[model samples]
Target: MKRSVVVRLLAAGATAATAAAIGLTLQVPQAAAAVGGVTGYATQNGGTTGGAGGQTVQASTGTAIHAALCNRASSSTPIIIQVSGTINHGNTAKVSGSSCNTADGVIELKEISNVTILGVGSGAIFDQVGIHIRDSSNIIIQNVTVRNVKKSGSPTSNGGDAIGMESTVRRVWVDHVTLEASGGESEGYDGLFDMKNDVEYVTLSYSILRNSGRGGLIGSSETDTGSGYITFHHNLYTNIDSRTPLLRGGIAHIYNNHYVSLNESGINSRAGARAKVENNYFKNSKDVLGTFYTDAAGYWQASGNILDNVTWSSPGSDTNPAGPSMPSNTTVSIPYSYSLDAASCVPNVVAATAGANKGLQVSNGSCTPVSPTAGPSASPTRTAGPSPSASPTRSPSTSPTASPNPPSGTNLSLASGAGADGSSKADGTSYGNVRDGSLSTYWSPSGATGDISVKWGSNVTVARAVIREPSGTSGSIGSWQLINYDTGAVLKSGSGAGTITFTATSLKKITFRITSSSGAPKVAEFETYAS
Candidate 1:
């Protein structure tokens, strides 16, 4: 529904034409040069060293990206495919109704190895098009913004992710990218990143995954455990409800990432997955850590993590915060040496480093990164979820001190949904947009006349509230009152779309009553945080 969601979008159910399995054949012209020259991108994991070397090729569209991927002279020769401009819905998986009946979607990197897809020039964007990596290895992707990747309306392919892989994918380094979405199942969007079917030896760094239901998943199903040795570091996961990451089985290193405003579950490790969780910043979220939502549990060796402005739900006996109760036999030592950023600096460090347009400005978090002379030598372990944050050049011992992040008190309005707005869009938007933690969607009053409010199950001590304006609108609220619904107290009043700072000591309900407006007002977010 919004930017970059279609990257991993998939609806329920499917047919032969609709199953998006890996290994779909790509039809490429016979004449294009197979050698590719790709450059000006970040180096990769899996022992890839130095700059992107090989033949350089340029592509301007989704078909062109696929062509570039398929144009490799041989599987062993590294080719660089520089993609610039927009890769839209053209030449992607075929769509029928809301579902894609074809197997391949957008750019399909199938049966190709030693490839680098670099976003060059002004940058590369995958809009409503999913990039499927199937049976491929030794790849690198950088400086790309994949937005509105519609999950297949039908389960046409396993690559219903912004950047996804299936069946024997290995050694992929995805860096400095932006993956986005609208909302979750209710909004018809899927995971920002999804990997499955024997996928291994992948690293995602300095990336941003935003506004979606699922962050990503490793291993296909509860019974699928062939995946392992994945590294997630220095990323930003924000404005999503859950699945900061869901790991099934593997040895994963999750460190130095920022997670903000998580609504439901976060860092779901299950089915024998093992994650070494270190030095991550978890803020304004719930269930920010641990195994959840399944009978089979996962494992984590967690340290140097900051849980600030966070809450947790009672997810039955399976959720283990200290780490999964799995035996030590399944654990694997983290392969690379890393430094943890003080949790206090995550929000700022990530803000400065974690996106495609950042020109690869990585924070010297709290440690200097030293690459091993060779690739990781360990046998294999398993893991998944949002990463952490740290200095790239120094350790926390040498970093400057900022105020420590505040821990989140209980969220009294967790169960609250959006209220009625007279001018709300009927096409697809809902009043719930205000609280969905999405930047692509928003709530608009049908008229200048209605009130927007939320009621909590019990009274909450609210210290701050932020009412974010929408993406593009000229209308503004001329007058509004922040009212305490349970006690009928006007906590504060405002006349514009900005931070609504007030102190509600304890209240069961709170509302923004719009008494007057210049036009039908729209709000991208109406959030309340407790400290």
Candidate 2:
């Protein structure tokens, strides 16, 4: 048979399955089958085309999945692994090779790239087993169910995370899957989906995460602030106590999701994290959006959301809720393109499209579920702007002194008074080099554009900054933004590197973000002064 004819047949089968799942009366052309694609932030960073144009394999056990990976030609080889049946601890074991890394009692996608795990047939269930992804990129996981994974009990796996990514992971799309736990930490279960330690450019779409103490988290802790650029859309979070999720630091665009029966809190953006929340439905939940359980606050930009029967707790020393009335405190700029379904129809849209064995139905961005082959409806792209109810407040600034040179003051970055972190560092470069006061020792991001920060343990007042390139390596830095990390506020933005003067404002951390660059930029010194 011709390849074109086969492709059409497969697409028709997918359409039929989708129609059946949604109870639509559509003419069937072929038998139903599973299909795959990427969306949201996963479509960025060179695009996550998992296993496209590669070989396809089938697996019914965890060991078989590892065998398929280990049998690949290279670590970067693209392969689609169609999974079915129950994958438990007994059927999972270590299967190691140069192209793959595996461990007993878990499905590990480690130190590899360009892979897809799609559930097929009746279903794919990882019962008491977990999927662990580390040091990998360009991956897709769709139409599967992972449940009852435990951290400190018999048959423990993946530290109790149904699906966890960490340690330099990038560009992962998890769609149309179900991740659930029996109970909370006391019940031996942990986060449903968790990302930490430099993970970036990820999306969780058309999925369900429920019945756990912790839904998930972006960064692991208060100081683990490197991860960012995540999108959570069209997912369902229910019966989770808190941390749905506790974002430590990063930028997350969350829209069109449904939250129900949140026992404690929902969407705990904290430790300098910024969340752009729009068009989501929160029903019978508590403290749906806020910085909670810590003194280190986070910021949010919210709009077009519906809160039904939701309640908020009173403010405390460590808890701040964005409720009783949802207001925008900061503006987050989303780089990618997306369509938002109306909040009024989110519950129905999510219910029909999310979870496994649902034939990969997706919202048309107009409150209707459609076959994946039909594609998402065209809608106006939205960047999180100021809400109509509130505008972002800026800190009081002091006028800069008239000086072509940097203002006469000590460089706050020096004298061991500050620390450094960033999105990613190139091989053989150090984040600390940017603040070490040495022209020869410099820092470069893994790519042309990234973020670097100079943070202090306590708040300090500064008004002037001088971003210096390595000697003889000028003009590498292009357009950039100076952001107050404490409040997710853009203080100064311009092109090139030179003397940058802003109002003297007290802040704990300041970031120099490179949006675009001509080449691999090198920062010899990031000097700050108080005038």
Q: Quick one: best TM-score, which candidate?
A: 2
Q: Tens digits of per-residue lDDT for model 2 on 366-394?
A: 78888877655333334333353343343
Task: Please write out the lDDT profile of model 1 over residues 1-531, one tens digit for every residue.
Answer: 111222222332332232222112222222212111111111212233211455565667654454334434333445566677877764443322321112445676665555677676888888777778877666778789987766556423334578888886756778778999877765667778888897767778778999887888887689887776677877899888777678887777777888988887788788988887777888788787777877788887777788877776655776655422222334455434443566677777777767786666554434322221211222122322223332111111111111123225443333454232221232355767777666577766444534566555556677656666666653476766666543334566657665555554576556666657786666666667664
Estimate TM-scores for all models: 0.57, 0.69
- What does candidate 2 score on TM? 0.69
Q: Which ten residues in a row have the lowest lDDT in candidate 2?
A: 23-32
lDDT of each: 0.60, 0.81
Clashing residue pairs in candidate 2 are 398-504
Candidate 2 wrongly placed segments (more than 4 Å): 1-37, 377-531
TM-score, model 1 to reference? 0.57
lDDT of 2: 0.81
